[model samples]
Target: MKQLQKLKILDLQDNRIQGLIPNDLCHLQNLGSLALSENELFGQILTCLRNFTFLREIFLDSNKLTSIIPTNLFNLEDILYLNLSSNYLSDYLPPHIGRLKAVIQIDLSVNNFSSNIPSEVGGLQTLADLSLAHNRLQGPVPESFGNLISLQSLDLSYNNLSGVIPKCQKRERTPPQTELLPTLAHGRIAYQELLRATDGFSDSNLLGTRSFGSVYRGTFTDGTILAIKRLDIMTDLACALDYLHHGYSTPLVHCDLKPSNVLLDEDMVAHLCDFGIAKFLGEGESIAHPNTLATLGYIAPESPQERINMREALAALKKIRHQFTQAVKGEKHEDCIALRGESVGSSSEP
Candidate 1:
């Protein structure tokens, strides 16, 4: 390894290298990149990384390395990327992990690290992508995280995090380039106006209920209409809502879509009102065959060999609804359920 001192790039990934990463590998002082991921390496990471002063990127994921991250690892001020995901690394990340000022991407996901993300992580003003998914981490995300103005992708999913999500804060900005028309009063409104408009979410404003919580509609003092769905904490509704808004790489599956669980805006535009049973697609996550449909009135008389997509089911139901001369609202409306339970009704929730 001493003969490779002049090498700037090393690709040892997927090599099934066994035992500890040799300390002498750090002798390559000119090395700017290293890839040792997807190997069976075990034992403590060598403490000699501080000598690789020019190293800008490192990939050590998918290894069996143990022990806390060494304090000297962050001495690489020129480092711009780090991937330590999918390892047996344990213990809380040092608060100084954020001291790697040049790191623009970090993947600490799929590890045993527990505890809250340190607030100092917010000081990484250049961070664009940060993934802490699939860990034992608990506690609310640090409020300082919102200070990452350059952040475009953030993943704290599959953790034990709790508490309401922090709302975006106000910052100084120039006046809008375009003037507001008489019809357009203001550019934006505050959430407090929404809470007050719902009369503190009195039941009279309630529009629907789901496994998570209830949905309400309210008109602000400014005549701004909004729908607020207050979900229960124990139901993990906050994470579910966040996933629906930002985590999915594809359109999500809301298998239990129903009128009572959906809220309509003033223009009749609909936003998903309940996330109690939401599932992200394109990630190998599947819809619960019976539980999902049962809540939406698709309880099958027999086990299905293949799952039916919601679009196909809705199309078939529309045909049935069009054929009904009496115009049954749906198979699960109180009156319709009574009739169906008596074996005299047809069609299900659309």
Candidate 2:
């Protein structure tokens, strides 16, 4: 630990590492991903770990860890994913769990954690998945949890949790707040306004037809010329999609991406639109729900009993990610494809 000053990822998971989790590891302040899951480790999750300000993930599940979860663990604002599930961890659910402002997924399931759900859990506006299943937790779920409009998958089953599910309202989708936030959410015309801009979406203004919708050219009252694709975004879409895939707490896949779902800006930057078919690829998830085989061919085709693999989906995302990286480096589009192809191909491997 003393020699590797620049070590960023310490993935010691799935090993026979035993005894106390080293409090000394916390001295490595630059540590970003600490994955010590699936080990013979025992003892409390060291409080010293809370000081690693750069730490973004903490995976210590499937261990013999005991005692209360350290209170200050939630104070680390940069943490994106946390999993302390399948341990001997006990004590009441911390009310300030919502203090993990940047957290996207929390899985403290299959433990002895008890008590009512915290109302403040809703304050985690960026949280997408919460799993407290198979625990001894009791009492009704907090109604305030309804404010978590960003939550996609929630598992309170197999616990003592009772009462009606909270009535949450849908809100604007907020991807990870990168430098590209304003590019996606800030400048937007109203739906009705789009209709008027495209002259009632008439065929005269239509630029092309897509598998799902149409694309058109439109001008606003301010004389701003914008390409009106039936999609939700432009080049910003690629950025956001890349963020959604690799930047978030968990892997996500946008199943429907094509020309119709892409918009072009005045500067010719492309953005993605409509995540009506996006899937969060968390542990033990499925793709076998109410969707057709139509949206799986832009990168890989589904032929003669050839099923599309999840790696192909990840490759598509990697393609977008590498594309943005090359563009930022001002590389030629043609040269970057080979570089991106190798990168995406390697990433698709097990």
Candidate 3:
């Protein structure tokens, strides 16, 4: 492969190619495009890829690649499109990412990357699309992001990010005007009007029912369609737990958290019920041993021996939710489900 020095393009995407990306390919210094996405390739990205100075596009998404993205990879100052999404990449997204001044689209979603997003990323003036969703990133969205004048799409969802979004100023170049949806003055719709739009919440309009509440597809007389969730039960539950765990000086743990213990109001708001086994952690204490036990399946694994705190329980619930989502999406998650079942079965054995 090193003999292919003059190769300008190398596209072997969507194949069953397995194993590490060969280093010899880096010898093609003049390569303008490289596409190796949707394969079974595993291992870290080639560090030598930085030597491909003429490379314009690199597609290495939907693979089993792992480890931190090489800082040198961002040295491709002339590269246009970069897709490294759906990998197992981890570690802080290097601050050097700002060096890709000419890149237009960048997708690094569905990875294990952690730490704060570098504010330097907003320096990519030519960036049009950016996605860093479904990662373990924490901290507020960078205020510098408001400077992305060419950004048409941005996604940072499913992260531990907090704080207010920076208001992006009007772009220098205005896009064509198009009416995508009906404009509302105050973004408020009357309850009676909503009822009428949803046909009094009829079964035919029902979209889906989650553990918290039901969603409906509502169509107005003006041919406007909207997906409306009747209740924010999960959000309410999370808020209640947050209050119990952090709002008060002494953190309180809801020892028994199960479907039956959650009560819903007429307005479809969820309330935590049955705090009979709730325990308050002492100063500097994290876990507590209670005389009463929570429902078997609802209890965390450490509940039997070393009891878990509210935060630990919440983390376990989040894991379960992620697994459930994978199952619903029909991904290859049977092994995870089977392992969970085995663990539950073992826990039940006296």
> TM-score for all predictions?
0.48, 0.52, 0.49
Candidate 1, residue 59: lDDT? 93
Q: Candidates' lDDT values, in order?
A: 0.62, 0.68, 0.73
Q: Identify the leading candidate in terms of TM-score.
A: 2
State which candidate has the highest lDDT: 3
lDDT of 1 by residue, 1-350 (tens): 88988776787999879999888887887776788999999988777888877677789999998887787998776567889998888888778877876578899888888988888888776677889889888998888887776576788889999875554343445466433222334654455665687887775565444433456666765554555766434223222232232222442445455557654334332334554464334444443333332243322111133435656543333333222312232533333122123343322221
**Which ten contiguous residues of candidate 2 have the minimum total lDDT?**
341-350
* Residue 160 of model 2, lDDT score: 86
| Residue pairs with backbone atoms closer than 3 Å in model 1 (clashes) | none
Over 4 Å off, model 3: 174-350
lDDT of 2 by residue, 158-213 (tens): 88888888877667555555433233356556777788778998755654433223
Order of the predicted models by lDDT, top scorer first:
3, 2, 1
What's the alpha carbon RMSD for model 1? Answer: 20.5
lDDT of 3 by residue, 141-219 (tens): 9999988988889899999999976776546643333333334435667777779888998855654454545666678
